[model samples]
Target chain A: MAKVGLFLGCITPLRYPGIESSTIDVLEALGVEAKILQGTSCCPAPGVFRSFDQEVWRALGARNLALAEEQGVEILNICNGCFGSLSESSHQLREDPKKLEKVNNILSQIGKKYNGTAKVRHFAEFLYRDVGLENIAKRVKNKQDHLKVAVHYGCHFLKPRMLKEIDDPERPKILDELVEVTGAKSIPYKDKQMCCGAGGGVRARTKDVAQKMTIQKMENINEVGANVIVDVCPFCHLQFDQGQEEVETKVPVLHLSQLYVLAFGLPKERMGVEAHAIPVNF
Target chain B: MSEEGEPKLVNPEFTKEVIKRGADTITLCFQCATCTGGCPSGRITAFRTRKLMRRVQLGFKEDVLPSDELWLCTTCMTCDERCPRGVKITDIIMTLRNMAVEEGHMAEAHKRTAGMLIKTGHAIPMGDKFRELRKTLKLDEVPPTVLCDPKLYEDVVKIMKATEFDKLIGERIDG
Candidate 1:
């Protein structure tokens, strides 16, 4: 139960504030103080900035981490992409003195210095590892056994298993186990570990290609008759939530935090189903 | 050189540059195609991660950098994880992309995204509509990001300037 600076990446705050509200609610219920990291920017986006300019990406990510450092807490990211950028940058900055010097050089212009001590945590991993499943299970006042969730661990949260080491990249069970804690069934589907096709700047550059990938995953989810898609990244959440409109699928999407909010039996309005393209059926 | 004496497309310097940019694992790729086999984007698009790695290893800078297929990788790291030779496939792709941007081959959409990040400190900048939604959610009008404080945003601008990212994308946008 360490304090966490809730790192709200762009999509969660700008596009899906419900995830923000619900995440805060769920964390408070679980007895974790979720501090808002003011003056934070984008995890600067991994695929876009990292692809375009690694130097810029590291500098911007360092600034965000520095913000959390000033608050004296671990940076808790709910989005897989944000986790990927911040954690990767933080890891590199910590391990490589030369790279740390380079990023600090950039930070110096902003009146900041990165000590490379900033720790980044994905919220799901924090809950699974720190909070423990039994504790989460105990807080579920409203069981969502009706929700057959197609759990998406999203790429960065698990893959590059060399770095993340969360679960078996090919056969992840973290999300499934977490989902089942709320009395929901995590339905196994084909290509369970597939990417949402929106990462690496592909969604922004090539919409049709991104949609094709989403449709493929949706087909697998639909075949399994999963009632909803549960994702850990706001980017993936956006892909499934909005991509459903193009593919004409009714399976709603929810961030893991939002799903927990529902399981906690908090007010439905806080989940912000109204902002969703595909309605949350349950 | 097939007797026609066509211009050589390879540039060893380009290969050296990619390695210098932190994807030295590019040399480890023996063209096993393991990177392509599991690539979700390659299944539907012309993006072949294995081929791209091959081109990089061969120093075919022209073939490697400017191709639209370079941007098609979703960087899922499936290929990176599955590589038996320990090639950091996604990292190589990212390195190639950075090199591509340096050569002025960025896609318009990605350039626009970079523009947004430069302007608002977020790749996806805030819209006026989200302000009302935040108020309805009983949250702050702005979510305490760089957008809330001009001085903090000025700090972001300084970082971008120091990195010359403002010059990289800004010059192209105005040009």
Candidate 2:
């Protein structure tokens, strides 16, 4: 069992502890040792902070990566926004020594150094590539045969295809396959690859625009008859869960960890399914 | 309609600054509207990512820097990914935003969120009801995050101070 540091970005720890708990439960159930990343701040939200100051964004991201490197473990992050920031910063710093030097100079003031050692891995990629579908299939005790899932591969998971080359950016099948491994049907939906309208600081800077984007996504999901939306990022989860309330829709949203925990035969109580704004009937 | 020619407003330094900020491929754009066609924000708002690209190439710094349309971008990267010219459209938008912040042209909501981030390490801080919800789930009332630890919160503030992020967002380090 590989011990991996978990980078729980701001939203997951503060807004949705359920996703945090379920992530731990699911990873532990899969025989992977998950440790909380100590003394970590926000992924700082790449869209928000990066837009304001790229140097600060790189420093913050490098700091988080250095934490995982000090533990001698790669990071397994739950939020796609964190994946974007950490992975992009790690990639940039690793590829460019000058940038690494600049970032390390900033980090050294606070007793830290990023030697460009740690790598960032999103939880979806971890479950699919590291855990393997066959191994996950064997452990599934409660197959969600009755559930129809609309998989939301949040933008950061597979965007800027150069930086995050995890899957086919246009038509990513990894999340769909991972969802299917739990015996749930990953239904096809319109604009499946569209942004959740929450990323890039849209949700903060402009409410009506963000809500309109969410409403459009919810309408697409409704058209596909998906009872619940399964997402990998908590920011996207928040957009779908709470964003639905503003749009007057009731589509239940589940983090991939929550869905995986559910299919692992863990009760809803253990997965913290009750914390959802739109209750999950199953 | 009298044909009175208005002065052409062009600041070549604007284009140079954007490239220096990491949108080095801005020159590759050939007025292709693919970015605008694919922009999600453009669909719902007055933001045209392609037009912004054109404005950058033309060095329309004054027009581009202080516009509300600049903040309308969600930075979804859809435009960047699909651009035929291989222009880093989204990064350019981010660069423009950084310049806007330097000129004190930030949106109010974004400033408020930045204040929240500096204070709580979260753009959207968790409310009390959500704290109660965590307890119901048998998890820590406050997850072991910056919100739960004073030292960690200070570390976040320290990084902000070092980067002058607090100052950029109109925050005081002493506070």
Candidate 3:
């Protein structure tokens, strides 16, 4: 059981603390030590900030990664946006020495630096590649035998394939396989790999466009009769969980950790299940 | 060939700027609508990712910078991932956005969110509802983040200041 720093992005801690709670609980259940990397700022949100200024995006991302690098542990990020920013920054900074020197110069002003030692891993990848599905399945005290789930990979988890390299961008299975390990069937849906309509700052800048995309995804989820929407990133979770409210759909949403927490037979109360906009009754 | 032909809208400098800003692949886009065809935002909004790619290639800075469609991209990278030409469509959009902001063309909503980030280190700052929910989860009312720690918040402010993010976004950071 290696020590991994949990990078809880802005939305997760502020909007969906339950995901954080569940992630911590599930990691403990699997005998992995979870350390909260304190003093970190936003993933600065890749879409909004990066759209306006790449240097600020890179520097802020480097700062967050520097925090984890100082702790000497790889990051275990639960949100796709954080995974994109931190992982992409680490990759870009390490691959390009000029960019590394430039970012380090900015970090020096704040007395921090990124040597690119800290690697960012999405939680689903952490489970699939590191924890092993069999090891996870062995601990499922309560099999979600009747549960049907629609897995939302969210764009950052698999996109820009050269950088993320988590799964096949066109056809992702790591998340689906993780869901299946808990006895829930990961149902295939139309445009299963489509963006959650909230990425790249769409939710903030354009409400109707975001809701329209959410409705489209919900229609697909509803078409498949999925009882729950399983996602690794909290931003995508917000789009499905809260975005559905505008469209008048009630499809329940669960973070991957929440499902694992349930499969471990942990009480739902421990994970703040009721806090969701759409109730998770299972 | 008559001298009355429509005036060219090209501004090669804009194209070169986008390329320098990391959208270097814009030149390879080849007018293929594959990006727009596969774009989820294109399906609903007025945002045409392919058209935007072409606009950048033609260097139509005025037409591209001030349009509301510029802010509508979700940056999903779906277009970039599936592009036949590997045009890095999303990165191009991001570069255009940066250029747009430099020209004072940021959408109001995005500006508001940027202001919030400068003020609180969060685009969507925590409110009372989240505090109550966190209490129910038995976690601290504010998770261990910049929200809970002023020192961290100051550190965030320092980074924003160093990067001139506050100034770029027109935020005034009081010492």
Candidate 3 segments exceeding 4 Å error: A246-249, B1-8, B171-175
Best-fitting candidate, scored by TM-score: 1
Give the per-residue lDDT digits (tens) of candidate 1, residues B20-108: 88899888888889888999999998888888888888888877787899989898999988999999888888888888888888888
Candidate 3 clashes between residue pairs 3 or more apart in a chain or in different chains: none
Docking class for model 2 is medium
Give candidate 1's error at residue A169 in angstroms. 0.9
Worst 10 residues of 1 chain A by lDDT: A242-251
Q: Rank the candidates by lDDT, best first.
A: 1, 3, 2
Report the alpha-carbon TM-score of model 3 versus the true structure. Answer: 0.95
lDDT, each prediction: 0.88, 0.84, 0.84
Question: Which one wins by TM-score: 1 or 2?
Answer: 1
**Candidate 1: tens digits of C-alpha lDDT, residues A1-282:** 778999988999999999999998999899998878788988978888999999989899999988888889999999999999998888888989998999988888778888877788999999999899999999999999888889998899987787887888987788899999999999989998999989999899999999999999999999999988999898999999888766755688999999998899887788866678787867
Tens-place lDDT digits, model 3, residues A61-149? 89889998898778889998988888777787888899999988988987998887887888888888888998999999998978889
Q: Considering only chain B, report the TM-score of model 3.
A: 0.89
Weakest lDDT window of 10 consecutive positions for candidate 3 chain B: B166-175
Write model 2 residue lDDT over A1-282, tens digit each, in one string.
Answer: 457888888888777788888888888888897888776788878888888888788888888888888987879999999998888878878988888898888888878898887878889998888899999998899989988999999888888788877888887899999999989999999989988898788888788899999999888998878888999999899888888875555788889999988899865676666666788877
TM-score of each: 0.97, 0.95, 0.95
